[model samples]
Target: MGTHQLTTINNSDTFEDSICDLFNHLESTFTYKRFGKNGHNQKGIDVFSTEKDCAIQCKKKDLSRKDLLIKKEIFNDIEKDVNKVINDDLKVKIDKLIFVSTYKDHPEIDEFCEILKEELNTDFEIIYWGWDTLESKFLANKELLNKYWSNFIIKTDSKETHFKRNLDLKKKIAKDFGNWLNDSQANRKLRSRILLRAFDGTQYPDENEPDEFGQYSWFRAEIKSLYHKGMEFIIGIDEIQVFEDYTWDFTSNDNEPKGELVNVAKVGQINFSDIIDYDIDGDEYYMFPHVFCKFIHKGTPFENIYYYNLDKTYEYFEIKDKRK
Candidate 1:
């Protein structure tokens, strides 16, 4: 409703908040919790409202069969958390496990969610808020909810107000996600990158990705060191230039000019949600997530490499001592 930016605009949290707001508006009995393999892991499990109704997340950069592994891992990870919420938190068993994310339903997602549901004995409702869901949930409300929240509530929300209100917020949030997706798609259009390394051996953040939700990222010339071993190669780049000094005429492989490269280490991105700071004690939760990552070394086929999430990147970044 307010025309301010989402401060903590994480894909998972935002998605969960939309779901939570819907449930809260409808006065549903729920509490969104952070959970995972190591006891409330939080890498996934966007919403853990009670045990009966729940929402999960698996953010991906690209929706590929590779995501099936992550989905399976997180889904199993939630079993104990969901069980605790059921037997411990709310004393009620869950009927369905709604797993939502930016990932669309491909052979991987479809096959995984169904297999996960059957294997885990929990109904996994996967929601991929791709452009389709965005248009239907947000663009659809363009005419009615543009200036009239009341009309929107009256029209779409009577029995399922939670679902309705969440859909409303989903519209706004998806706009941002769509924007990030667009940028990524644009970068992909280039189809090539020229890496520029650092002299100080300092690690830099990704370049292609400047997202509010930074689970998936790309650092164009993340100048770490002189192309030593241990650091994995990223995909889609044309060539890499490891210079002795920071000074380099960094440009596209075709000599096209882009943004000026600075000495600052481009760090991970953070995204805020519209529902941040809203009291989230009694709201149900849901999610939409996608993570696309690959490494391109020497212009050959890029290899896909999966990291946990943006948080891990930040944590790992901070823990690393400044390159000597």
Candidate 2:
């Protein structure tokens, strides 16, 4: 597989300029129209591809850093660009709106895009192109990679080949873990061995453990309880904050018991699949299943929160002695 440094492309301004060029190389029929260098007539649109009938906006963010832009900030940027096409006199009949960026994957992007579509009353589809997705596209087409990275010495294998190799390794681990489970008596008793370690150490607790904010140590204690019950490998997930500057009120609404408080750690949109990106607390543990259970407020729709149910029972997976 190609070992060219994509970070160099991420850190340079040329990446934004070359985005349309890269897409053109991918699809032979693609035609890119730049809004202009002066940024006067462009509105919010950056690059328009005639072949796909797509209006593309290229955003190059600091991929090395996380939470650089908040949720509203990202929404606002995309909204303005979409409006420029819909409301402007040009009436650019775009079938698809594509946003290409170098930022890490944001789970809330899909929900936010749907909200925008509903608010605008449009039928256009929204697509987000993050770093990993872009990497996949580059790997699928080496010509596109060579065109962008002039210094890249084309490797013998493609990116798809490299991905398959990694995926195969993960499957082998899962298979081995499954085999160990089938061989063990303890694991065979449990219905599900899913791990729900979402908020182990997200917050700090003080002298008085307030029920409203909840104790940060609660998750740690829960894990201990699970371990005592024969759960060996545990999986936990947390929200990657969308808004950096805003503070959420932890108080519960009038719907619940008077003194009982809602768990504030359970707030925001989280993609459990992204948990693979999280570092394990050393090699003592490994990831098995890649799934998530999202809890959202029924009244407000996309207002999602994550909370660990202390009393909930899941099928337990006893860790093999070797992993310990």
Clashes of each: 40, 5
Best by TM-score: 2
lDDT of 1 by residue, 1-324 (tens): 322111212455444555454434334455655443335534335555564465544342333335445456545544554454334544233444555444433445456556654665644354333323332344233442333233333233253664555455545434533433334422433232223222111123322322223322323422111111112223322222223442233234675543333222222221121122111121232112212222222211122222111322323212211134
Instruction: Tell me the whole-model lDDT of each prediction, alpha carbons only.
Output: 0.35, 0.49
Which predicted model would earn the best lDDT? 2
Deviation (Å) of 100 in candidate 2: 0.8
Off by over 4 Å in 1: 1-12, 22-44, 48-52, 56-92, 123-131, 142-324
- Candidate 1 minimal-lDDT segment of 10 residues: 221-230
Model 2: pairs clashing at backbone N, Cα or C within 3 Å: 192-315, 197-236, 198-237, 266-305, 266-306
